[model samples]
Target: MMKSLITTLLLITGISMAQPNHLPTSIPQTMSFQAMITDTLGNPITDGMHNFRFRIERPNPVQGGQVHVIWEETKQVAVVDGVISTVLGSVTPIGAMPFSNNFSLSVALGNEVISVSPLTSVPFAFNASRAMSANNATHADTAHFTHQAGHAHHADS
Candidate 1:
């Protein structure tokens, strides 16, 4: 009998707040993914290397709503005492993913899929990034509007 493995997924993002006047030119698009592999008996399986497939999916239905796969990639990861740690987007850039949308993660080991789990709120950092960019643009637009209004008032005088 093939023992089924259980995996626990953890998602992490790095977010930093800059000063009002100092905005970062760019934000990192990578996220950290860690997993622990264990057997039914709750014992960690110390596997050397395994091909782990990860999928980020959102609900999309034809009539109502169905699950759709937005992004997927298989990577060879080293498991030490059943703990696997790797940075997502390192293999394939996930910058284009719709992080603002609700998504879930699916994990597969070899030909057998292990588990499908809901993603945490950590992905909101991507939306936060967009907000930061919008803040900068808003400031620029306000400045332009002020300058333009000043010129118009001067012309009226």
Candidate 2:
């Protein structure tokens, strides 16, 4: 029987403050994926290492507009108490995959295709990268500065 699926993909950007002078030049190319492996009867699978295949896809404009697979890889993940927590792109870098566009993910546990989820939101860090590219100005225009005079009056006055 097919296993029940509860899957999540969260893109996390870790800013290192320990080395404030050495900030990262680029956002990380990985995301955290978690799923609960359960049987059809809602029982957790036995805790152990399991093999899973993952694919990142987008809608293809060519070939009559089918889903296009951009990346795929197999990974061995450790499942504890029916929960599998793993970081995607650990084996291979998902470098510059253009998460700015619509994308979806598909997964297969062992030999069974388990779930497909839509990637509806892009991480805030990704948007920061877009802002950097959108700017063309080297200096601030219409800049202004002002100074105000200050006076103190006596309490009695």
Candidate 3:
């Protein structure tokens, strides 16, 4: 019995140590994604009730092909004032960490012909940006970067 216990303890410790310090310790990380989709005229779009589908496309198949699109979440759209916002709150399953293809959020305006592109959000890494210069030089708002396992944001910054 003592021998078995020791073996189990050693195995567990080995597995734990093998995990990189930067990676998240938890399994399947579900995160919320939020975005505002507007029209070219800067008006909140009201195309019936829209639905926001959060998709984390798996990275590609190649050894390092951006991970499979492993994470996907869906939620209805909500309009506050004139701006429309889409939020999938904690819907993604834990362990769905796909390699980061474009972390994309798509808004279904219900019409493909008159589709609204301005309402679309780019990959997950991009945050809403504001221009600090008169020329409107755009820089992402860094306050919203998410912490993921095996990823280091502070060190990258």
**Per-prediction TM-score:** 0.60, 0.65, 0.36
lDDT of each: 0.69, 0.72, 0.47
Tens-place lDDT digits, model 2, residues 1-157: 1232222111122334334553465678888999898987999888999999998999988778789888887999999999999888998877777766788889888989888899766588677565555423223221111011122222221
Q: Which one wins by TM-score: 1 or 2?
A: 2
TM-score of decoy 3: 0.36
**Which sections of candidate 2 miss by over 4 Å?**
1-20, 122-130, 134-157
The better candidate by lDDT, 2 or 3, is: 2
State which candidate, 2 or 3, has the greater TM-score: 2
- Model 3 ranges with Cα > 4 A deviation: 1-28, 47-49, 58-68, 82-89, 92-157
Off by over 4 Å in 1: 1-24, 63-66, 123-157
The best candidate in terms of TM-score: 2
lDDT of 1 by residue, 1-157 (tens): 2232222111111122222444445566667888898877989876799998988888886747768887788899999999999887788767666656888888887867778888876577668666544423323333433342322222222
Mind giving the per-residue lDDT tens digits that candidate 3 earns over 1-157? 9999999999999999998756444443544434455677877666555655555443355767554434455556665654454334455454633332344433344343222122244464353222211222223233233322223334323
RMSD each, Å: 16.3, 16.5, 16.6
